[model samples]
Target: MQQTCVIGAALASCLAAGTALAQDDATLAAVEARGVLACGVNAGLAGFATVDSNGVWSGFEVEFCRALAAAILGDPALVDFHALPADGRYRELVSDDVDVIARGGAWSIGPDVRRGLDLAAVSYFDQTGFLLPVELGVSSPKELDGARICLVDDMATGPALDDYFHAAGIAWQPVAATGDSEARSLYLAGDCDAYARPAAELSAVRATFETPLAHVIVSDGSSRVPSGPVVREGDDSWANVVRWTFNALLAGEELGITSANVREMAATPSSNPEVNRLLGTEGEIGAMLGLPQDWAVDALAAGGNYGEIFERNIGENTPIGLARGLNALWAKGGLQYAAPFR
Candidate 1:
């Protein structure tokens, strides 16, 4: 009887181990078999994720997805973009409807600790602020006490707004909208006194207005908004691929590897050990991640470096025209610093 019990216990333990191993590599195996990276993006937020007149998607987040595809599939075009509503992003990831969420979603304690999701990395550092029509002549968010504010219904901003108002001992009404477009519409139509969103997105929203100069982003009541890609929990391999892809973007910028110069640098190895390892000249870092040695090269080729992606999408020349306040490289006095490639 004792021998039979031991055998049965061993069998059950082995089965449990096998199940855990399968769960770990499930996402990566599915992505490989599908031959495409499934990326979730915002429906239509200019400068972050938007479709052009020709139905081509292009933006900072879009470029990240393309880079990820390039790294994994060796082709930047092998990406299936899903336009997801803000509230449904987490559900989509959990349900396996999308592999990764690259929308500009703020990382908060609820999603990270409570929900079975992981915010991989901070792609863009932003702050939450209020946008008001200049006609109101409101210089500060505090001046709008008891006012109606347009906010996204399902986001960290909802709770953040509530906390801010409660702490300030102010009364306000929330005019919830399904998405940024709806929020902007309500704000523009005078349904709300102000529109609350990330300052970067507020600029994008304002650009769509007929008279962009008529609106102003309030400088008060701001909170840190660190947005990034999100993936389902318990898949460290898949998460690493997404996280390191973002790091490669930042590392490429720091190493001065641009789309225009990556080919040349790859062909001719440099004396810099970090640059060589990053470009697949020295180490097997890519192989460690189950990718080709030239994975970073493909990523950089897809969207240029991180800096180039920003400059092309939302830099001073673009309508959004955001300066690299906290998004710049750490060496250049910004917060964007990547882990060592080694």
Candidate 2:
């Protein structure tokens, strides 16, 4: 009787462990079954994520979602975008309303650890900076003491701005704007002395102005915020997909692969081992992630390489005109470096 009881107990324990393992990948299974990758994006952040009058979504972050869908579903168009407001975006993810949040938000220790969220990667390195009229003749933030600043209320930029001023023993007043458009309007109307926001965003805002050269970005590296996509904690499979999809984008850029040439490059495998592995010519990276061997190819086809996406969306020729400062490849003294595929 005792031997029979021990065997039954061991069997039950094994079954419980198997159940836990299955639960770990529940999110991935659901995504596959749905056949559509639902991505949570910003309601309207010009260069990051925004919809046009025709309801077509196109932006830097939107491209990431399309790439994810292409890698997983083999079709970039098989994606459902949920426009989320800043305050409730995380909540929507936690409640399983969205599979992933690709809206670029600053990654901080507090949100990652306390909010039960995982920041997939630092897709964009943003510096907290101030934008004011070039006529102010202020080349530095320190010169803006007692300045009234227009800031977005929902982001961490407002607090970071306060920290900078308080630490410098300077006094300033903050005029909180509900969103980027409002902040820009407030600043342009002379309601605020300076507009405080991420440098990339400020650049985008400046470009929209009637006179682009009328404003200057004053940044001394007081605060550097690395922003990226977010996924629910405890789902390793889903997290890995999002992380590697971003890496593949970076690798494509590093290997000189672009949307226009990805198919040709994949057809004729490269002698470079890294390129071959990334393009699925040499190894089984895609299978390891439960995807096709040409997953990276599909992703790149959807959005082109990281550099290509940047140049197409927010680069020098675009209204944003943002140079690839820290976003440049690591070989060019930038922070974007992809891990080895092999």
Candidate 3:
């Protein structure tokens, strides 16, 4: 039989005639049975994931895990954070070391669907960028000709940087670093003229510098990457739960229901039916997902909505000081609107 592609807004990949896309819920069962959510996160990237001196895990990745736990187990603190290494995170996920691995590069064919893992959703829209001294007077990436650049080894940005500079006929000296922290250390020690990494991470790293005002980040559209949570394939049920957890965060933000106001909002069902349905006072949305009606309330309470999470952890007011450029809600002209709860 000849195969035909059925691509559309609904279907992302081509389905074969005899392919069986199973919806196993073993991961979900294990998570519930074990009474905790085991989530994989980066070992120690400032804005994304970090373990503080108090043995508390906190950051964007941390909040996602906690929210997932809140949805599944009814408590945000019922989480086991497994700090996975950069090169070994996928292997750990494949081995079932954690229920889900958060904070991957982007949604791509090989790393996601083709590799037997599903990208639940794009949690954050991040782009790779360059951090250089202000004195360099370089406002754009194309201006970095013959400059020593430090980049973390084995990142997608390598090929991207190569293509960007090669096409522009720009030459740059490459300084090797093992990871983001090393790149920051080397850049701070003046081992290289610039350090390259994701713009959010660059902002977080730069904020820790003694002379933060002396540095600047150069971002380009070509380096944009869609980063989010990754789960093993063949489990659409579990993936749906993960995706909706993110949606609830976004929905909370879009509906003006923040962590501070979520309890009040849930306690009193206002004129908005969607808000009532989301908070579990009106509809069976949680029951449909095999969760309690108050699941969203717990998730929202774990952290604030998406906007609150960004602002608290890495927004312009925070130490990381990243602006909500493309992360704002769709109603506000950003690309972060959620699908309907119904």
RMSD of 3: 5.9
The TM-score obtained by model 1 is 0.94
Instruction: Please tell me which predicted candidate would have the highest TM-score against the true structure.
Output: 1
Per-residue C-alpha lDDT of model 2 across residues 18-105, encoded as one tens digit per residue: 6777866887788899999989987776677888889899989899999999999899998899998754468789899999999556
Rank order (by TM-score, best first): 1, 2, 3
| Model 1: per-residue Cα lDDT over 1-342, one tens digit each | 133323687888877776777888888789889999999988777788888788789888899999999998899999898888765567788899889998547788888888889988999888888999898899877787999999988888888888888888889999999877788889989999999888888888888889999999985636788989999888988889999999999998888899999979998999999899889999898988888899999999998998999999989899988999888888888899999888
Candidate 2: worst-modelled 10 consecutive residues by lDDT: 1-10
Look at candidate 3 and give me any clashing residue pairs: none
Please give the CA lDDT of all the candidate structures.
Answer: 0.87, 0.87, 0.84
RMSD (CA, Å), candidate 1 to true, equals 3.0
Root-mean-square deviation of candidate 2:
3.4
Q: Report the poorest 10 consecutive residues by lDDT, candidate 3.
A: 14-23
The TM-score values for the models, in the order shown, are 0.94, 0.90, 0.88
Report the lDDT tens digits of candidate 3 across residue range 1-342.
555666683244544323433336678888999999999998787777888889998998899999999999999999999987654467778888888987776556667655798899888888878999999898988889998989877666667678788998999888978777688788988999998777877787887789899999997677677889998888777998999999999999989999898999898987988898899989899988878899999999999899988888888888788878888887777789888887
Winner on TM-score between 1 and 3 is 1
